[model samples]
Target: MTTFPQHSRNFLFTVLALVLPVLLGAATILAKTLTVSPTGKIRSVKEAVRLAQPYDTIWVNAGIYHENEITIDKPLAIIGRQQAVLDARFKKGIFSVMAENVLIAGLTLQNVEESFTKNYAAVRVRGGGHVTVRNNTILNSYYGVYLEQTDSCTVSHNLIRGNAKQESTSGNAIHLWRTDHINIVSNKVSGHRDGIYLETSSNSTITGNISQNNLRYGLHFMFSDNNSYQRNQFMRNGSGIAVMYSRNIIMTDNLFEENWGAAAYGILLKDITDGYIERNIFRQNTTGIYAEGSSRLLLKNNEFRNNGWAVRLLGSSEDLTFEQNNFIGNTFEISTSTNYSSHNTFRANYWSSYTGYDLDKDGTGDVPHKPVKLFSYLLEDIPTSVVLLRSLFIDLLELMEKVAPVLTPENVLDNEPSTRLNVWKS
Candidate 1:
């Protein structure tokens, strides 16, 4: 055994303690690879993904790649220089990422298959976190982007659209399941079953998106809690949006327009509780706001115009406040159920149907306006009464009901109404 001197041993230990972390970091950096084109060696995208190490970047050229099921198992960034197309030819998903910290950007994904059993998406992220999907164009897929069992993902600035005629096997544009902390921002989504859907998700923020022409709700949320949706547009869908079976939600500054069906509503709240719905616009829908079995909701500063009904309450709601809203050009301002009296209050709202004269001119209506129309009560009992909507006999009956309170609920009235329209005009 050879023994070192005391001074030599001390110097060796000091050098090792100073240089060990730097050497380990250098090794980690060397493990990452950077791929570039014009090298004439990397031929295909599949070859690049296979040759990529962890934390690698595969820079693709501007061309069409006819491929399907491009599985990404390593944490790599796949970027395109120009307009790179990944055409799936209606076969399967284009990109399937199962690794964390992956980035997919500046690519056009198209022609994903429509499957009856599986959700064939253009990009499917499974069990991945910290993934960023940005600046992509996804077209004609069953689903544009599908996330399952993922967390802390960011989907931003993507254009996703599906063919509306293919309704036999339609999916959502951005479908999320059992995920959390998802940030969906500035995406244009249209022509699917639902534009954006969140199921069993929590703590997600969906903002600055445009969703239109969907067969179902534009933004559908179910069993998701503690989510916030703001500054989105929902237009020309069967139903504008629906938030169901959720609690502690916040919806602000969303636009709902032209969702005109017999049962269509600008926004539907079913079995939801403890939420804030503020500063939304509902225009030209069959119904502006529909609530059933909901409680403890605060609605403020919303605008309702050209809808069949401004608000509909189905007798199961309680502890709701409708304040500082504008109800204009609607056939009916509100409709209430005949079975039970609701515990909701409508205060300080501008109703175009208010007929009471304010003699004192204090910027408030002197007498209350009973918003529940007589025909709405008849529709509740006999659903066929909608056929006589514009008939003269129904108008006469409505006049008679106004003279004498007949079928409408006594407490369903809006008092202290605003004199001017509450138009945000933003």
Candidate 2:
């Protein structure tokens, strides 16, 4: 008797299968958009966050929201409209996002309270992967964006500034610890202890950033490897950039300028090996490039202009090559060890102070030019002797030392100097 209704039963089953999935898909999409507004139904950002599901987006309205310890435990997109301000003056830890696949964009985070025991930050990403933080302004915080044990994060197009007058209390603009696959691009960081500090980070790229007026080094790397820095500007910093105990690094096309101090340098390489530094510009720094305990490094096509000393190598550096570089308008071209000859080579470089003859009509100078002046070696040994830099007596002593080869290293000279200037008009 039931076999009479077989066609109706089959039609009902087909309708249920198709309609069920369509309704579920629509409900899931609707659950992903969570909006926060003062006049809307979702009153506060915290209330909107509680009602949000995974992969949801919480859009904050434009106003100052004083909150305490905002936590993001699930995958969500927190967006701010018209540069909404999130002031955490009374809060201990401002924003701690601990999940993966999170995106925080277009927000202004300011006034994150500092602590002695805890290292608080404006935005702390802990154990997150595939996170994106873009187009945000983070100011007046201990640390701008701190990444701890995270991977595959992209931080770009952000302005991070901190209080520089309070040196003991201020933190770095961007600090990365034990992270990998990080790409920090197109950011402006200033007025902190250090602009960017990377420790135990590897396989990262830092490009197109401006780091200026920091208390310490603009870019500091410690125990980091396989990292590349390109097209960044370091200006008015205490020290330009420092790389320590790192290997296989590539630093190219960067501008290190105005990092002038009593003990400062455009780039400081300490215990670094197998690195390439090319096409960089060092201008108006105390020492353009200073190396200590570095080995097997290649310095090529760089411009050292208007610096106190173009290059300074301590006795610990060995097997380094300084080739095809332009040393122009510097107080001293090279300063090296006084007693022993360095195992470094300086060939085919344009030295502005070279006055040797080119008798064979070739583009290279016929006679070798002693780059390390005796006066420079004296200044290195005795810092107070720098007062005699422009004296005629010091010039006469330098000329005599160049001809007789005394007091300074004998083999630390540029044998094949370029006849024409290696001007980088670009």
TM-score of 2: 0.91
lDDT of 2: 0.87
Off by over 4 Å in 2: 1-31, 423-426
- Deviation from truth (RMSD, Å), model 2: 6.5
Cα lDDT computed for each candidate against the true fold: 0.88, 0.87
- C-alpha TM-scores of all predictions: 0.90, 0.91
| Model 1 lDDT tens row, 1-426 | 999999999999999999999997885677655554544577567788998888778887877788789898888899877868888999988999899989999888999998889888888999978889999999988899899999999999999988856557798999999999999999999988899999999999999999999998899999999999999999998777888999999999999999988778899999999999999999999889999999999999999989988888889998899998999889878887778587898898998878888889888898888888899888877878889997999999989999998778988767888877775654
